[model samples]
Target: MIVFDKVTKHYGSHKALDDVSFSIRPREFVILVGPSGAGKTTLIKLLLCEEKPTFGRITIDDKDIHLLKDRYIPYYRRQIGVVFQDFKLLPNQTVAENVAFAMEVSGKPDNEITKEVMKILELVGLKDKASNFPRELSGGEIQRVAIARALVFQPKFLIADEPTGNLDPVTAWDITKLLLKINSLGTTVLLATHNREIVDNINKRVINMDKGRVVRDRRRGKYDYK
Candidate 1:
């Protein structure tokens, strides 16, 4: 479970997040929907420990993430996978290599890396493109590689920040379906997106934010701004 207790973040005199609090149960798929600068990115950064809250605590599975020492941060981060809008894949590496690199960096054995990489590639429906480079794949395929890489470690939580922002409508929905599939496999997902169509279509738990505050949160919620 992930819990945010009265979380607040400030940048000099400006407030990025203000007394925001929410909890995500295990295996829950939650969408964090908001316009740009609605504190969505700040919230993700706090969860990822990229930035610390000025005045609150964030705990995952009863462990406070903000208290982790610098040296232990990497290990903690490994438990949460993050996918970005850019599909950060190495242009020179094959899809398989890109996914394997995550495990390799964590010092996993080569045999285990190969096995896990193949499994994740198949999970993301990119098994046929394992040998292909990022430049050779379509936008959707590249995002699949990104997701596969994020899942290589079998993270307990998956946070996708605009994973489909760069794809066409058809391809975007394809990526969305893949995320839903990942969630179905038991990885808790926190998707931050501005796409109302996808949010309304998915009809999952929605947390709507504006001006650094959560205005509404509901199950089977549609995208609405008031």
Candidate 2:
């Protein structure tokens, strides 16, 4: 479980997150929706241990991640996977090489890198394109490559930030479905998006934020209170 207890974040005199609290259970698919500057990104940064909370603690599986030593932070981060709106793929590297690069940088053996890269590329439905460069794939396929890269470590938590923002509706839904499929496969998914269509259709747990606070939360929720 991931718990945020009375979390608060302040930048100078402006507060980015205000006394927010929430808990995400294991294997849960949760949508976080809010307008800009509602603290969604701030909260994610805290959860990823990229920033420290001004007051309060975040615990994962009963462990306080902020308390983890600097040397252990890398190990801790390996358990969490994050995908972003921009597909950050290397233009020069092929799909397989892009995914394999993640493991290689972490010191995995060449044999294991080859094996796991194929396994994840297959999982993201990109095995056939493994030899193709990023320029050869579509927007959705580029995003798939990014996702495959994130999955290389078999992370327990898969957090996506506006993953479908750049795609067409049809393609966006395809990516959304892909996320749903990943969640069904037992990975906890925290999707931060303001796309009303996708949010209304998913019908999963929704946490609504406004002005740095959680205004409402509902199971099988819609995009708005109305």
> Per-residue lDDT tens digits of candidate 2, residues 1-226?
9999999999998899999999999999999999989898999898888899999899999899999978887878778888888888889999999899878878999999999999999888998999999999999999999989888988889999889889999989988998999999889999999799999998899999998999998888778833
Question: Model 2 segments beyond 4 Å from truth?
Answer: none
Best by TM-score: 1
**What is candidate 2's CA lDDT for residue 46?**
89
lDDT of each: 0.92, 0.91
TM-score of every candidate relative to the true structure: 0.97, 0.95
| Poorest 10 consecutive residues by lDDT, candidate 1 | 217-226
Pairing residues by index, what is the TM-score of model 2? Answer: 0.95
Sliding window of 10 residues with minimal summed lDDT for model 2: 217-226
Per-residue lDDT over 30-94 for candidate 1, one digit per residue giving the tens place of the 0 to 100 score: 99998888999999999989999999899998989999999998888888898999998988999
